[model samples]
Target: MPETVFEVDVDAAPEEQPDPIVNRWHPDVPPVERVSPGEKFRVECLDWTGNQVNNDDSASDIRDMRLDPNHHLSGPIAVDGAKPGDLLVVDILDLGPFPDNEWGFTGIFELDNGGGFLTDHFPNARKAIWDFDGVYTSSRHVPDVRFAGLSHPGILGTAPSHDLLERWNERERDLIERGPDDETAVNHETHDDDPPLALPPEPNEVLLGDMDDEAVEEAAEKAARTIPPRENAGNCDIKNLSRGSRVYLPVFVEGANLVTGDLHFSQGDGEITFCGAIEMAGYVDLKVDVIENGMERFGVDHAIFKPGNVEPQFSEYVVFEGYSVDEDGTQHYKNANVGMRRACLDAIDYLTNFGYTPEQAYIILSTVPVESRIAGIVDLPNTCVTVSVPEAVFDFDVDPDSLAEISSEGRGRAARPS
Candidate 1:
C-alpha cells in the first residue's frame, strides 16, 4: 500500500477544546445562533457515499446502495443568532484524509451517465472503487493507472428548517419511485459559452469523443443555478478543502446544520468518474463558528493553500483565489477578479510566522486557484462555496481568523510568528 503522507509545514499550534453549543454533533441536536466573521471548523468527513461503502468493495455492492446512519455528518452546530437572510461563513481550516490511502475516490460522475455531454458514447453505468494501494478498477474496465482517489464529502450543508427538511426528506424517499424521466423530477435548462482550458492535457487519448467541448460548454450553463452547485460543488473535485481556504455556508435553521461524509484522496478536474479520489475510514475534526451577514452579491468564496505551495485553491474548479478582499477591503478588484492570491496570503500568514514578501507571494498566487469564477451567485438569499486542495501537499498552523484582522496593506507587517 502506498503511504498517504501529508507533506507541508507541520509546525502549526495544537488544537483547543471545542465549544459545547457549536461543537455538538447532529443538526437537530442544537439550537441556532449567530457566529462572528472569521470563525472556523475542522470538519470530519467520510467517504463520498458517507462511508456506506469501502475500499474493498466492488461495483455490485454500491449498485444497490443504502447509506448507514453513522456515515452522514458530524454536526449541525448552531451559530448564535444566525437567522434568515444571513450567510453562515464556514472557513474550512483543513480536511485530513485517511492516511491509509494516499488519495480518496468515490463513485458517480456528472456527465458520464446519459445525463451529460458524452452520454451517447459513454453509455455504461459506471462504478468507482479503490483501495489503499492507490489502484482503481471500474465497473467494466481493467485497472490501468496507479491513481488513488482522495475522498471529500459530496454533501456539506446546514439542515433546512424542520418543515423544509421534512419536505425534502419525503421527496427523497419517493425519488426512486418517481424515476428519472418524471417531468416533475427532471428540470434542465441549457445555455452557451464556456471556460478556457488550463495546463493542456499531457498527450492524452481522444477515445472519449468530443466530451471536452461538450463538457466545457454544458458545464457553463449548469453552473448558473444554485441547487446544482450544492449538488456537485460547481465542478469541484473530491480532494479539495484541505488547507488555507475556508468554506462559507448560509445558516438555515438555528444551528448551521453541518455534515461531511464524502471523502476523496485525489480527483480529476471535472471529477469525470462521478466519484472522488478514494473511499476509506478517517476522522474529521471541526471548530464550528460563524461570520456576521456573510451573504454578498456575486456569491462568496475563499482561497486555500499550504505554505510550501504558492498558488491558491478556490471553492470550486472555476474560481481563482484572491478574486476579492478578505473582509479587509484592500486587494484590487479585477473585472474577472478571483481572490486566490489574497487567500494564499491568508493561508501563508496563518501557517508561517515569517510571512512571504509581496513579490514571492504574488508569483505563486497566480499559478494556482485555476478556473476562477462564481460557482453560484443566486441561491435564494445567500450563496456558499468551498476552497479545495490535495491533502498530501498541504499543512498549516496559524489561525485564519487573524488574517482578517490586519489591513491588506499591513497583513505582511502585522503577521508575526507566535
Candidate 2:
C-alpha cells in the first residue's frame, strides 16, 4: 500500500492552522508536526513577500513595503528517525496556482535601496503582472512573450546544530565589528516579541515547548537572517529545482528539522534586481527520507540537488561580454561586480534597440532566465564576464551575427578588448 500523505496549510488562521511558518530556521523552534521517515506530505506556502503585495498591487506598493526578515517559510517538520550527521533527502513533487487566484507579479527594486545590476541606468520601481495558463506564463509588461513555467521552492533547508549556530554568529559578528560602516550589519532582533508573520505554531507564542534552558538560549540568537545561501540551504534560488528534483541537505540538528517556503512560480538565474520574479503562494508536495553519514561519504558540506526536467532550450544565444579594466588600463582584480554591471548595461542597450525602454529592458533582464557566465579570468589585465539571453524567447528571428556586432558597438562605458 502507498504511504499516507500529510497536509499542512501555512495560511490558515492561528486557531485553524495545522503547520507553523517561520521566518528564520531555529533548531529550538518546536516542530508543528512530525513525520516518520520516507513519508509523503503537502505544504501550502505563502509568497516570498508573505502575501503583503497582491496581484492588484502597484509599483508604489512594492516601494513602500518593508522586506526585513524576508522569505516566510513553513514548518520545521521533524523527521522521526533523523539525527545530526545524517543527510535529509527531499524529493520535490509539485508546485501550484495559489489558494484564491491564478496570478502573480514580477517587480524591480528602487535604486536607493541596495540597488541591483543596472540600478543606475534604471532607477524607478516597476511591477509586471503575470497570468498563469497551464504550463506557460504571459506578461502584459513585455507583450508577445510566453515562456514555460519553471516553478520551484526558493528556500529549503534543515535547522542548524548548536555548533553550526555558534560558528555563524561568531563570523557574522566579526564581520560587523571589522566594518562598522557597512550597511549589511547583522540585526540582533529576537523572534520572541513579534507576532508570527505568516503561520505561528499551534498554541501560539511557545516555540520551545519543554526544551532545556541551553537550547532555548541558543534558539534566541536565531540563524543569521534568511538571505544568503549557506551549507544548510536557505535561499539558494536555483531555478532548475522544479518538480521531480531531489535535493540532499546536510543534517545539523537532531531529527533534521526540515523547513521550506518562498515558492516562486518562475524565476531566472541571478534573481537580478531582487524585487521580483513570478512571485506567488502555492502548495509543494515532497517525499522526505534520510541517509546515514551521507555528508562524510560524499565529501560535500553543502546542499546538492539533481534537477528534474528543467533545461535551457535555446540552441543559439546572443552573448554580450564585459571587461573589468578601466579605459586607461587600470586593472581591478576580483572586481567581478563591475564586469556584471557592464554586461547588464550591454543587455539593456541591446533590448532597447528592439523597442523596449531602459526600464522594460531591466525588468526583462531580471525576470528572464538569461545565463551569466565568467568567461575568462586568466587574462591578467582584464577578466571577462558574459551575459547570454536565449534567442528563442523572442518572437522575431534573431541573427547571431548581427547581435554580435551590436554587442561590440555599445559595450558600456568601459574600454573594449584589444
Give one digit per residue, the lDDT tens place, for model 2 in 150-178. 78888899888867866776676675445
**TM-score, every prediction:** 0.42, 0.81
- TM-score of structure candidate 1: 0.42
- At residue 47, what lDDT does model 1 achieve? 41
Candidate 1, residue 191: lDDT: 24
The lDDT, on a scale of 0 to 1, for candidate 1 is 0.34
Error of 2 at 101 (Å): 2.3
Instruction: List per-prediction Cα lDDT, in the order shown.
Output: 0.34, 0.67
**Candidate 2: clashing pairs of residues:** none
RMSD of 2: 7.8
CA RMSD of all predictions? 19.1, 7.8
**Candidate 1 structure quality by residue, lDDT tens digits, 190-241:** 2222111111111221111112445434322211111122321322332355
| Regions of candidate 2 where Cα sits further than 4 Å from its true position | 1-18, 112-114, 180-221, 326-330, 398-418
